[model samples]
Target chain A: MNTSENMKARLVDYIEAFNAADASRVVALFADNASVEDPVGTPLKEGKSEIETFYTYATTVGARLELMAPPRGSHGNSASISFRVHITGQDGRPAHIDVTDVMDFDAAGKILRMRAYWGADDYHVLADAS
Target chain B: MNTSENMKARLVDYIEAFNAADASRVVALFADNASVEDPVGTPLKEGKSEIETFYTYATTVGARLELMAPPRGSHGNSASISFRVHITGQDGRPAHIDVTDVMDFDAAGKILRMRAYWGADDYHVLADAS
Candidate 1:
């Protein structure tokens, strides 16, 4: 498969893992030494343990992110995706988040690192019907 | 100059050209037979004349697009930018638009074609206080 297609498949797995609350599946997608950086200001998550901790918290807290845009980047072992996340917030509310996930890939197409960018102020938490 | 820097300079020129309402500045950046596809459903603008027509009408209507994100695509002679646009709607109102500009470049680093993706429904026309 081409690089872009390979990258997309990995992203789909990651998305499914989040939605399903399968922390192990999500953690398995990342390399053992992989790091996760969401936004420029936030501290980076390095190593499988740290990344595992981050995803475990977000997914367990009921953040179900639904993607809006497809993965878009070009001809590299990397892909940057823009997506809108729908999730149940801690306040028992629904929230929308626009995020850019910059990801790097390994030779076998596994995720090496992912840096996410989204500003907290742009989106607001709204009361959920459920 | 590096590819990203080259692409950014061209985009800045394109932005300034829009703000200054200069048709030639806009046209000069694109290649002679370049195609412009704004959204998947719209027809592509092939060649300089069509491109000129599109820009002339857009800028003439006082649509000034200010970029929010620096060029983010990596390596290749391509860049995808995300921006929040502030414009004066025809009804004499201020409007905010969120747009993504996907641009491709040649080996010389000039933009060859551009595909823009944004939905019209996301924004609404409001009365301008000015």
Candidate 2:
């Protein structure tokens, strides 16, 4: 597979691992010193240990990501993925969060940096009926 | 128009001004103290003067942006746009750069923060024959 295709596959794998609540699998996709900053403007979590902790907490939230659009613009060592995250809110109702993650990869194809873009407004507490 | 539509219109206007190489028009879309980090990992250009200088240099590169996909996931005050930027390289040949810009808006609807995501590898020099 070409670089773009390879990156796309890795991206899909990362999401699948997240949906499966496999924190180890998700964390393995990153380099030893990778950094993740969810929501772009937040502080970053660096290194494998910190990344694992972040994902561990994330997986416990029972969030499932559904791709809103096919991953777009994979070039060189960078790729961007957009998806809708479904999770149960504190009120035991469904919540939807729209997120776009921009990732940069290292030579070994491990994610070196991940920046997720979304704001508080990107989240919606779905009606209980739906 | 609602918030999403308004943000989308602002995004389109930004691109249109970029394609027109009108630096003033392009910079006007941003707030006076807006911050722009093109390519995500770069040091930010903060404030109108710095932002205008960045666009000034960019516009001089003879680049035109073509939307690769409709602006996606505008919620609250954030929006993201994916596009292909065509530019004439030093070799006097066409170069295509794929870019994704995630922007945050202020209450006044001007861009408060703009983060452009793309790496050097996202650029390709088209063959003259094409």
Candidate 3:
């Protein structure tokens, strides 16, 4: 596959791993030195160890991601995936957070950098998917 | 209208003004001290004067934007619009660039910050729309 296709495939893998709560699989998709900055302006988590810890905590809550759109603008060694993450809120109610993750890849196709874009207001409590 | 609807309307106005090549209208949608970071990692253009200059140059080149999808995840005074920008290349060939612009708004519904996400490789020459 070409660069765009390869990167998109990696994105799919990342999302699937997240939905499956397979933190190891998610961490393995990144390069050892990869960095993740969720919400863009936040402090970044660097290296596989930190990334693993982050995902472990995230998946422990049974968070699941459902793609809202197919990956877009996948070109060069970068692409973005937009989705809604479903998780239980502190009140034991279902909440959905809209998120878009932009990723950059290394020559070997491992994610080198990932930035998720979403704000606090992006989260909402939903009654149902319908 | 609520915040999300207001932001989405502003996003539509921005795109319409861009397609119309109305630099002044585009600049007016932003606050006097607004900043634009096209491609996200580039040097930001601060203030309306600089913003107007940027749009003027962009429109002068006959750039046009077509929405590929309606604005997404518009909430809490922020939204993102994904589109295809049509421009002529230096070689006089037709080119299309895929772009997603994420915007943050002030209480007055003026754009406070705008970040466009796309890379050089996102530009592709097209034989036809099909």
Candidate 4:
């Protein structure tokens, strides 16, 4: 089992890499056969190829993540983080989505699966968005 | 599908009920067939009977929960909350455990499954504990 410290460190790296817009750095945290189901109900992006594409698009977008609290690690092969994703809404207004991501790690310390939890109502247009 | 508002409301209620030390109130939020996996790797407490027993002990232990972030809702039948469980350690010292709980709701808005994420290292004795 991966140590709690190691799992939490990786989660921190994910946030930093994403905020830096380094898609490669973000993708490198996942296993080759990893699966990502962002928003929990969405179709999964499977394998490194698809996962790479997903991160590329996500990183390129002007989205930034702000941690809501410290990352949490499980006794099992999982860890979780809660954050807000700031982005431009369809109407060109600044908005943020409240999200919690749970990641399951492999023996190699790479993310094997990631599921993000965020509902439609979680999106909020910033009051200052004009 | 349970509405996001309803899901989030119940999560709030759960915290309130727990803090109130009202085990019955907390148990009422769960489905008849609900299953609870506290701390991920632990054996599950299945069904309302087992779940009720689990919460009864939890609530009676003088453990208090402090939310680290707002409850998060998913597009599907799930919601999550990150919190700190404040309690007395085995040595009778003040301690806390950082935990993230994910709940899957049934169509009727009752929690069908609940999983808590926390590792052994997540439990920490307060600095003031001497």
Candidate 5:
């Protein structure tokens, strides 16, 4: 795959891993030192260790973000993508957010870093009586 | 500067450029093809030309994002940063948001890509009755 396609594929795999609760797979897209801060009661995972720990918290309480095409520009070893996030809030309300992400690549085009920006509270959280 | 410090300095410079309405300085941190999507009524500027345009919108509204230290981890050419945004909403509310950003670097530590995540609605926008 090309750089952009590979990134798209990797992002898809990340969502799949999250839905399936596969920690290892979710961690695979990152380099050994990748970090994340998901905050907003989701997954504020940082670094390889914390990222693993953060994903561990999602073993039961279901949360998923179905992603659409992102706003993006790719050049050489770097690309920025913005995507619409459509998901059912934990409480089961209709939730949506358009997220923009910028990614840097290693010489081989592997994901070196990924940053995301979105309006999380725009999501209406319903009462999760489940 | 070190990778992390260089990134921080660049981020600071970006804010300064915005405050001063210096589009050229703001566009310097990015690679020739860098992109931006500052949604939520801010700046959804993409590509070089669009980024320049987005900054143009802020010239008169007097908008600014006073950034604090971000949550971050940097090793090699990658890092994730989360920071607190304390800004006077267009309506002049005591608005605040904790934003997380992920950045990637080229082999030379030049920023190649950047992604931002924030709660814009969480931002208390004053009615800009200006």
Candidate 6:
């Protein structure tokens, strides 16, 4: 099992790598066969190849993450982070999505599965967006 | 599946009920066969009876929950909340545990499963606690 410290550290690294737009860096943290179920009800993104493609687009989109609290680690091989994803809304205005991501890690310290939680109502357009 | 609005409302109610030390109210929000894992990797308290016992003790202990962020809802029947649990530590000093709870709801809008994420290190003693 991965140590809690290790799991928490990796979660922080994930946010940093994603905000840097370094897709490869983000992908490297996952196991080759990791599965990602972003937004909970969506179909899974299985394996690194598909995972890489997903992150590549995500990172290129200019969305940035801002952590809401310290990352939490479980006594088990899981960790979670709550954050806001700043993005451009459909009307080309500034918006942010509230999200919480739970990740399970392998013995090798790579993420094995990741599930993100967010609903349509969680997206909010900035009131002062210019 | 329950709507996102309903799910989020229940999560908020959970916090309010727990803080009010109303164990029955908390248990009412759960299904008859609900399972609660207060800390991930710990044994689960299964069924409403066991869940009530668990919450009865938890609420009686004078612990209070403070939300760290707004509850997050998923596209599916799931929602999450990040919060701090204030309690008296082993040293008889005020401390807090950083926790993130992921709850899955049944079709009728009752919680079916709850998993709380918090490792040992997440428990912090307030430096100013007298």
Interface RMSD of each: 10.3, 5.3, 5.2, 0.9, 12.9, 0.6
Docking level of model 5? incorrect
lDDT tens per residue, model 3, A25-87: 999999999999876567899999999999999998899999775565443456777788899
DockQ of 4: 0.81
Give TM-scores for every candidate, taking all chains together and pairing residue i with residue i.
Answer: 0.53, 0.63, 0.66, 0.96, 0.42, 0.98
Comparing 1 with 2 on DockQ, the higher-scoring candidate is: 2
Give the clashing residue pairs of candidate 2, or none. none
**Model 5 chain B lDDT-worst window of ten:** B68-77
For model 5, residues B1-130, the per-residue Cα lDDT tens digits are 3444565556666667767867777667666566553422234455767766766765445555554433232433444443444566655565654444555556555556655544323344445445
lDDT of 3 by residue, B9-114 (tens): 7889999999999999999999888999886567899999899999999998999998775565442456777788999987788998878787878877789998
Docking class of predicted structure 6: high
For candidate 3, the docking band is incorrect
Q: What is the lDDT of residue B87 in candidate 4?
A: 99
Evaluate model 3 with DockQ and give the value: 0.17
Tens-digit lDDT track for model 2 on A14-127?
Answer: 899999999999999999999998866667899999999999999988889987645644435677877788988888888988778878889998999998866566678987
lDDT of 3 at A9: 76
Q: Candidate 6 — what's its lDDT?
A: 0.94
**lDDT per residue, candidate 1, A7-99, as tens digits?**
777878788888899998999988887888765346789999888898889888777766655554334456555666677666757786666
Count: clashes, candidate 5 = 14
| Cα lDDT tens digits for candidate 4, A18-111 | 9999999999999999999988887999999999999999989879999998888887899999999999988788899999999999999999
Off by over 4 Å in 1: A127-130, B1-130
TM-score of chain A of 4: 0.96
RMSD of 4: 1.5
Q: Which ten residues in a row have the lowest lDDT in candidate 5 chain A?
A: A68-77
What is the two-chain DockQ of model 1? 0.05
